[model samples]
Target: MTLPDGGQSPDALRSGTGGGSWDGERSGRGLSEREPFDLLVTGGRVIDPASGRDEIAAVGIRAGSIAYVGPVPDRAAAYSRRTIDATGQVVAPGFIDLHSHAQTISGGRLQALDGVTTALELEGGALPVADHYRYAEDQGRVINFGMSASWSSARMCVLDQAPAVRPQDDPRFRLPLAMFDQFQNGPRWQSAADDAQESKIVGLVERQIAAGAIGIGVLQGYAPGSRLSEQHLLGRLAEQVGQPLFVHARSMAPAGPGNAVDAAHELIDTAELTGAHVHLCHLNSTSGRRADRVTTDWATAQRSGLRLTAEAYPFHAGSTVIGAAFLDPEVLARDGISTRSVIYLATGERVADADRLLELRETDPGALCILETFDLDDPQQLALLLTAVTFGDAAIASDAMPLTYTGPAPRSGTDHSERALAALTGDVWPLPDGLIAHLRTSGCFARALRWLVRDLGVLDLVEVIRRCTILPATILAAAAPAMQRKGRLSVGADADLTIFDPDRVQPAGDYTRLAPSIGFSHVIVAGTPVVDGGDLVPDAFPGRAIRGSAG
Candidate 1:
């Protein structure tokens, strides 16, 4: 092992830093230099928010790890043997959507089309994250993907029923039994439900973590019965695992018992108390506080740094299942919400198939309230979007309207397919199909991004790209580790990249239910192009499940 002339022998040099780390598990030891690279993405804008670099750069890929990132100096330099001409296009890391239900429910191929490289399924919106992650990995997903252990889904899966009150607080757990007659009167359900709630849920979270869930998703609105203690428990578990907690506030209903502002404050305080990295989901809703009010509350909370962040869709309207729309109007009086603030996203005027709507209300109430007005006027949306274009890592999401369910062949007797489909997805407010279709199309994200580069003129292209790339990656890492490597286009970064002609690039927003946003040119994932020249390239899934190393 001794050096001959001051330097080690060639064999030693080659053996020391070139082996034993290909799998990347070395107890804090870094990777060596000789692993076979999987792919390389070269010649792109490389808007790396992490390194504060936004210029022409090349990324080297080896063994599925980024081996180098920086100006290539020369394409002939001693860097990557492989390269991609991302010149005149964006080479920043892939886009990450934090709470996208569409990610798994839509088969994820759709999200890949939208240039979303990493999709984090959260709360109750998607299937159990572990199962979905496994499916993705088996397919060798072309886009990076992760999941959060959904609190609502977790509890529901455990209890196999929803509660009416915050049951965790009561020592007896009797309050829910008294409040929800169904839980009380059901057939031998209470005891079984209780056991399922306590033991199965804990086991489920652990299993998801073992299966590579990045963090936990907490959607309180979806689990109205989840008490403060239940949320605290979820936070504690996530904190123990060093994962992020995605929170969709419980009472952000336009007609709810608490103002949206109050909900925001509540989340901030909960985060402060629980010591969890709290990501507030969907900043605007009819039940959300007024835009001006939310601005003040969010500013103050963010300044305090309760590890808080929020996401917003670019459109003027918000969408959800109709059952949420039918949340007791009396709650408006309790929460001091103004009914005028709410506008139906899907439901409008006459109820679609009155009988169907009634049945949906009783059994599967959350059919479709597709879109509605809540917070942030069009002007405010423009301001936020404009600001984000320049400042990277704002954590923006498409929040595209996605179908929740594709049920079995409709009964031959069914007339309105949309209504029947809506029932399957939990839509109760069945409105006209033509009435609220805009919120579901690509025009939403395009229009939002457009207001920035064109009308507002707030940010240059570099800054806008950074926000979408690096900034979001950083924010997501604050909550989930999978997003950390995803937002960069440098050496050792993932090969997920997007290249589009700036001049020719345009948002193709056509509100057709049949096909939406089907055009994206050259979507490269993991150093492979999935979409070329605005068309899908088959047999091109290069994605994989990203594991969280923090825990």
Candidate 2:
């Protein structure tokens, strides 16, 4: 029998290696004379980035692991179980999101329609990693999920004395939108940590890592006035634990001491000094119009043997809470960010002036807003954004924000006190109208395929698939070896696959009407098909937890 990578030799007719069971954690059983194949996908072009093979093939699955991939002569008759006729589709490894904040069942459903099988919260991760995992397990996710150890969450837990629990745990608890907004006027956001306080914060993060956080999430950009010494210490901690530090660099000012360029250097310097794997998050919006220079600097550093990587979403605008440190009037003025460029999602109001912006910041510091950083119509600005998206081997992450319903809380089956956390992690399906989130939540991958490969011709389909799969999996391989089994289609790899029509796969979501992207025929997680024939399987929950080795 032939193997998954087109029978091991250049010719598909030749048989090089036989299929057998591997990786007991994910696989079910070995191929045997008595057992029948569980599922067979036939008549499609299989693109396996890990093996560098792209050809027409059939994939056989048994017990959640791929058992065989070759030219199936008998098609359905060879396998008595389930069969998928992917006649006009491309079967590729399911997209892996390296940075996502949509950790709810509703969010997972939206992402599944966009061809994602795994979505990780590495940029703004969760605190008390164990609790996060427990909650997700109890709720049952639609796709494989994980998170990093949130440094900002740990900081607030220590410095601001914020309650580190959901509203379910305490009557007075509230879900802070971002780091500095944990408290309306808290001084801890701007103050440096004392030696003891820094040690305490480090201990909290370390404990969470041991509890199964994939890495450390450094959201220093939200608290730009905070000291750098704490970040240096965190870098050292990540190196010691062999986990990468997912960093949102401090400050996005245009041309000052704490500009994006300086922040890029700081990350590179920290990687060099501490010997840690530092991941720069959201290079597109964070680097603003200077993406060309920032990407060049990072590429040079990477060539110099520094352990650094970056991710960027395709959109020119960014979504965050209104109280971000960079949204200060002076900083915005220096960067030429007009007040009109920012739109409040709750009220659908564009800030008329600096006074209105400050009033909103003071009154509803945790409100969500969208910042238009670039005009796609302008060729120069569009090219600047593309510079980051097309950077050498950079992963394309969604940076998907949490879904929110601006309407009043439901009167039945919902407690007034538990409204915030409930909506954040609820199983609300068929999301109600007036739900507000960035279009990236449901359209990032489809949009990337549409814009980068088909429209602009900047990259090929195979290269974009690599960025979505193997590259992101390789980035986290050191911390979570389980990822090595994901992001590819091979004999022993987990049966997580995305099958779609190249011409038809297009993002349907927009600012006014937020709809799920269409065109994925099937999305398999592990061995089960969560999306079958372009429809969601209501009962399929085959997602598994991805955790750090320290756990």
Candidate 2 lDDT over residue span 67-109, tens digit each? 7776654536546387888887899998999888877787888
- In candidate 1, stretches whose alpha carbon ends up further than 4 angstroms from where it belongs are 1-44, 57-84, 105-107, 125-129, 161-207, 253-257, 286-289, 325-360, 363-369, 374-393, 404-448, 458-460, 478-481, 510-520
| Pairs that clash in candidate 2 | none
Model 1 C-alpha lDDT per residue in residues 61-80, reported as the tens digit of each score: 66554555544444322334
Q: How close to the true structure is residue 51 of candidate 2, measured as C-alpha lDDT? A: 77
The alpha-carbon lDDT assigned to residue 413 of candidate 2 equals: 59
* Model 2 vs. true fold: TM: 0.91
